[model samples]
Target: MRITTLAKNYFFYCVLILTLFGQNGFVYSQCPTVTNTAQSFCDTQSPTIASLQAVDNGGGIKWYATATSNTQLTNSTVLINGEDYFVDDNTGNCGPRQSVTVTIYSAPTGANFQGVCVTSLSQATPSNPQFVINGNNLQWYTTPNGGTALSPTAILTDNTIYYISQTNPDTGCQTSRLSVFVNVGLVPTPLGSAVQEFCNIPGSPPTVGDLVASGNNNWYLTSAFGIPLDLSTPLVNGQFYYATTVDPPCESSIRLEVLVNLYEPNDAGSNGNRSICVNEIATTIPFDLFNLLGGTPDNTGVWSGPILTTNGFQGTLDVSTMTLLGSPYVFTYTVSSALCANDTSTVTITILGLPTATVSVSPTPSCSGSPATFTFTGTPNATVTYNINGGANQTITLNGTGTATLTGTYTANTTVNIVSVAS
Candidate 1:
């Protein structure tokens, strides 16, 4: 009985020793060990690839601590797309007390192959960037010039002008646009001047050009209008002319203007009498004409000559015929020109045998905005009273030894009646 008890005790002691020393015999700890907690898979064409870990749980006489080894990869295995590979826990770093799971998944594929082609890679200002292929939807990222897919189609007019600028981090600069150039296939038309005034002179009609038109066609002028231009008429100032289109697309319109000039006439000089007889003497009266038109008037007339000293015309005509003793006669001399139609002057000489003041009252000419002046000359100490339209409004009386001058302005078209008296 004593031997039996001792043997049982020895057996229990042996089991305890084995349990303690079994764990400590191995230098490394008895923990599940994997080559790495995480890893990145390299981009490769291979379908499948595998890896491994090594570990030891126990031995015959001692419990070996957990041990790990460097990961080993297997490239020969067939890699299924979109599939995962689970490592065997028992055959790897997994211990009897602990187990580890490693998940493996296939990587995504590369971008679709769109042949190297030129594309408008731009995001126009005031317009978003967009990309389209034959008007089809596509996915692209933001590029240096714009984003991957351009938004809002660009309005291209000239098909020949195909240029795109781009920037990239890896590539300092580039223009990866395709070789095919986009053609808008249209040109812009030019514009012509429009006339402000119209003229009736056919020969000297003001000329205007092609007004602006749409499309790429060239422009020209024509006589398509039924009313032909009066080529014989001289284009006067303040006249407007029109032009008809003569191009392939006919019936267009244009205009032109002719500017006019305003001129002031020379005042009549003082004369001794309306009639002179026998050896009557005549003196040349000095006259001053203010050309206010800012230029010298053309004195191309039988009785008109240039002043030679200033912007004025000077001339003298013999009126001795009217002053001759011949039956008391009256004569009138007229001076005019075509260049300045509104500017004309007349001088009247009357051979009065007695003292008579012909007080004639008539309505003044109607002018839009011209100044009017009234004066009395050729009389010795003449006193005069004038009434407009015989009304009290605008009536004046003046007494002077020489010529009396009075001037006033008109705002609009006006009519005036004048009553001249000499006493």
Candidate 2:
């Protein structure tokens, strides 16, 4: 029995040793992992992945993707659309590695988002000033190139160039923009011009103190309302009238007429003291006057009548024909024109009565070489001188006109000169 038990023990020990050696001799193989190497391509309506995948020997797998070429799957994660895709090790086949590609479709949901804006109209001095546009961040360009753009609120900058576009966001198709322009200016102001015309015989010379006054009927010195005007100041002969207003560039003007006046010589006379005989002619008096006051003439004045008119009613009056002049004769001289008229009074003219006297001669008649004497005379108060020749200032003592016989002359050859003196 003992020997049989020992043999069983040895056999069990040998079996244990053989099992250990056999386990040590066997080899285990591991599979490579799979990964994604590229992002997906667009196929019809969906996205399919372009790929590289890896399977590890321990039945683990990972996948990666990149936008760039030649990227290794070990360092990259596959992104489809905007979401990230990771390696799925759920079906683990260790030996063979598989590849997967992720596709980005429908353009990541929000690419190239866009909006439009317009500029506002701006107020300017000129009615047609320029309008400019401003926009938010965008990758847009002008549609028509070198003209003008429509901006945020339709406000414009002057003399600036621009380009506007009506473009699609996703696809870069655009519509053409018409050109726009702005200018600067305002409405112009209006103006008026004027002239004048003169009257009074056109070209004839005027008399002194004579005035030619114009009438409104001839369109002289007229207002816009056609009212007759007495100017604030007397009108000057050769000057024009002018007035103005301050609205936009607008004014008025008209031709005016200015009448001129003339003045006469100041020949009005004044009376003086004088005396005249019954048959003497009238003498002219001398005087002159003028209107020192600012008085103008009344055209239709009347003078007291029964007055004789000659030489424009300016002749001398006859006082010499009055036979009796006791208290002195008085007369008046009157002068007139459109300006002024007045009468001047004369001083008295007195007349004296005549006187009577007698005359005589000296020397008697005698032949030549013979002498005789004869004498008679009035009071010496009535004395006389005699002359034989007709010399003007020569005087001879008047012995008598018959004194030629005393001198032995044949006939009386003497004339008498009388001397009368009044105190």
Q: Which candidate comes out best when scored by lDDT?
A: 1
RMSD of 1: 23.3
TM-score for all predictions? 0.22, 0.22
Measure candidate 2: CA RMSD: 24.8
List, residue by residue over 1-423, the lDDT tens digit for candidate 2. 999999999999999999877744421244343344444433222332223334445535444242222333443333454444334332432223344444333211111211111121243311221223222122122333434434343434443333433433323433433233333222122222233222233234332112222211212244453533333334445544333221222122333333343333223344444555433334423211111111332222222222232332333334434554352554334444543234343334455333122333345444343343323233222233433334464222333332221132324454333343111
True lDDT of residue 328, candidate 1: 39
Stretches of candidate 2 exceeding 4 Å from the true structure: 1-252, 264-266, 277-320, 341-348, 352-423
Candidate 1 per-residue lDDT, tens place, 1-423, comes to 999999999999999999788755452354434454332222222333433233433421111212333343354555443333333233343333322233322222222221111122232211322112321122222332344443335443322323233332222323233222332222222233443333223333433322232332322223223464444434434434443333332223432222333233422322222333233434423323322112343453223321122322443334444443444332222234443333334333344332212232123537545666655443444444454444564423344554556665554533344444443
* Model 1 worst lDDT run, 10 consecutive residues: 109-118
